[model samples]
Target: MNNIVSMAWVKEHMGEPNVVIADCRFVLGKPDAGREAYEASHIPGAVYLDLEKDLSAPVDEHGGRHPLPDIFDLTVALSLAGIGNETKVVAYDDQGGAMASRLWWLLKYLGHEHVYVMDQGFAAWTSAGHPVTDEIAEPTPVKFLAIVEHTMLVEMDQVQELLGREGVTLIDSRETPRYRGEVEPIDRVAGHIPGAINRFWKDGLTVTGSWKVADEQAERFADLDKNRELIVYCGSGVTATPNVIALQEAGFTNVKLYAGSWSDWISYSENPVATGDEENA
Candidate 1:
């Protein structure tokens, strides 16, 4: 009974013993604001996960803003957060799925499959009439061991190989505008990697903000060749997880996320970048 649970399921099981809920509510404006909000109010048993501080690594000139943290450090922090191997971790955030997917992908990278991003996150959780508590719950530290799976991640070399091979689909999860080189928000380069298709991550969610059902998701992605190799990317790899998670829920098994994503691709300057209404030309 403990796979990915919906907002309804979270509501039904709030305050249930041993249930570890993480408040991943984050704001790009005041990046530390999530921790501040957790200090102010959260679900009774929820723990705070700061997107900038706890979730991602320090920004360097190479990795852009949210680089992946060192595995050892992240595992220790997860253990300190009371998430053990067996603990079911549920992540949530505002702006739909952005921050939550970062945590979800990190957990998966560590080879823990018991974690999930809560559908709709705090907005849905609050709308469901769930009580918010000013009190924070302190729990004993649990051991979280890292077992990294290299295959779950894709690097630039692999992407280059895939580009050469036929029957491979490269998906860019950024919005149409960003993918089309309309604006450059975070990175200096606006357009996506060359030959990548656009499928914005926000489209994975229903209008109500929850993820679409499995059947609907599967049907939506049916047009894409499921049996062929599929790779997903986004700016610095933060927003790509919604599309990755959606592909998984859609029953596509051969999905891989480009961890370095467009940021790394653009860094080389030698790598090709296509722009402006160009469809795989």
Candidate 2:
């Protein structure tokens, strides 16, 4: 299936055994509110993937806030949710694919490339007049085998090398406020990595909440040399994923993600932090 599927496409093939719909709605403020909404209503056969409980591992001083969970633990969770190696995962969320992109990236890192995020997410599904069910989908166990692709992840040392290195593009996916060090909401450090460019993840979408067309998305990166090594990161590495999708859609290859992102960078006092309105530096 395509990386971003339509509601009509889902409605047609949703009942297929290999098809698995996953709801990834998450609100940072109200941690459990997403599950509550899922219980109230979701697309039929959609299983919930909690951001903190499922998407992230135990946080510590070394790892960022949303470290990748253990492969064994994630595999067990995926098995319980009926996600096999061959399963086609369709992930969705209300936040313009912000939350759902985490699931998409995880599946890609696991070397399972048959996963996708719904454009406009649950909002589009409901807007299309699709029926929602309150009944919880029964867990159908499947043997999920995951092989982590290290190419999709980068460590602090690697990031350090890219700080002033040419031929590489480091993208900071946080908003202008955080990137500029004007406001410190979540982490100890308020600024971004030195020499990184700010490209807020939400900019990949339209005002209507759906992802921008590929050509429109390409325009956002027109200034960049596509031949360069592209690395994307955000707070805890969650929001940076949509840009990965956008980049891929726009046909820019050789992309990697700094999974620990700004959070992990700030954890080390030695890492220099950049602050200002500089979109690219």
Compared with the true structure, model 1 gives a TM-score of 0.93
RMSD of each: 1.9, 1.3
Query: What TM-score, computed on C-alpha atoms, does each candidate reach?
Result: 0.93, 0.97
Q: Which tens-of-lDDT digit does each residue in 1-281 have in candidate 1?
A: 32257877776766765567888888876877788788887877888877777877887756646777889988888888889888888888776878888888899889988787787778667777877888987877998888897778887878877784788888888889999998988777878777788888888888878788888778767778878888999987888888888898888988888877888788877778788764541
- Error in Å for residue 261 of model 1: 1.6
Question: TM-score: which candidate is best?
Answer: 2
Candidate lDDT scores, in order, read 0.80, 0.88
Q: Which ten residues in a row have the lowest lDDT in candidate 2?
A: 272-281
* Superposition error at 151 for model 1 (Å): 0.8
Model 1 residue 263 CA deviation in Å: 2.0
Give me the overall lDDT of model 1. Answer: 0.80
